[model samples]
Target: EPEVTQTPSHQVTQMGQEVILRCVPISNHLYFYWYRQILGQKVEFLVSFYNNEISEKSEIFDDQFSVERPDGSNFTLKIRSTKLEDSAMYFCASTGLRGLRNSPLHFGNGTRLTVT
Candidate 1:
């Protein structure tokens, strides 16, 4: 079974610093997405990328956040300036198919970002 892989399982940074979280989705998958969960909150969708462009994005994906696929296999999320509230567990996910109402998303273990 193919799965998403994320680097640096844990990261600690000071507020106002920049951070880039990297991920490699299942090679054959076509849809990629980034989701996050605050310590005690529900998972929130950040953005979805398909066909080399952003297919959809949540309100949380503001000017401070960006996503890219520098290569065909690697997808990355960058936060320009971290804030205390930005601390969360960020997950990278992918799906092999699209347009199905119930298509499942396979997720990575997540990178725990701690901003102090």
Candidate 2:
């Protein structure tokens, strides 16, 4: 089965450095999303992309963050200036179908972002 794959399961960076987290979503999937989970918090939606544009984004997706489909399979999230609170688990998810209430998204193990 096709699956979402994320690189560098754990990343550590200084509080104000830049970091690019990468993911390879399922080949046939049409919708992609980024979510983050603070150590003991709920999974918060960051952004959703489809048809090469952002479909929806949350307040968490601020000026310092951006996403791109640099290639056919690679989806990337770049954080221009990381903050200490940015430390969390970033998850990449994809759905094969669009807007289907029953379409379950498959998620990667997530990249643990650590800021110091």
**TM-score of every prediction relative to native:** 0.95, 0.96
Report the error of model 2 at residue 105, Å.
0.7
What lDDT would candidate 2 get against the real structure? 0.94
lDDT of 2 at 51: 85
Instruction: Give a tens-digit lDDT track for model 2, residues 63-104.
Output: 999999988998999999999999999999999666655899
Best by lDDT: 1
Name the 10 consecutive residues with the lowest summed lDDT in model 2.
94-103
Candidate 2 wrongly placed segments (more than 4 Å): none
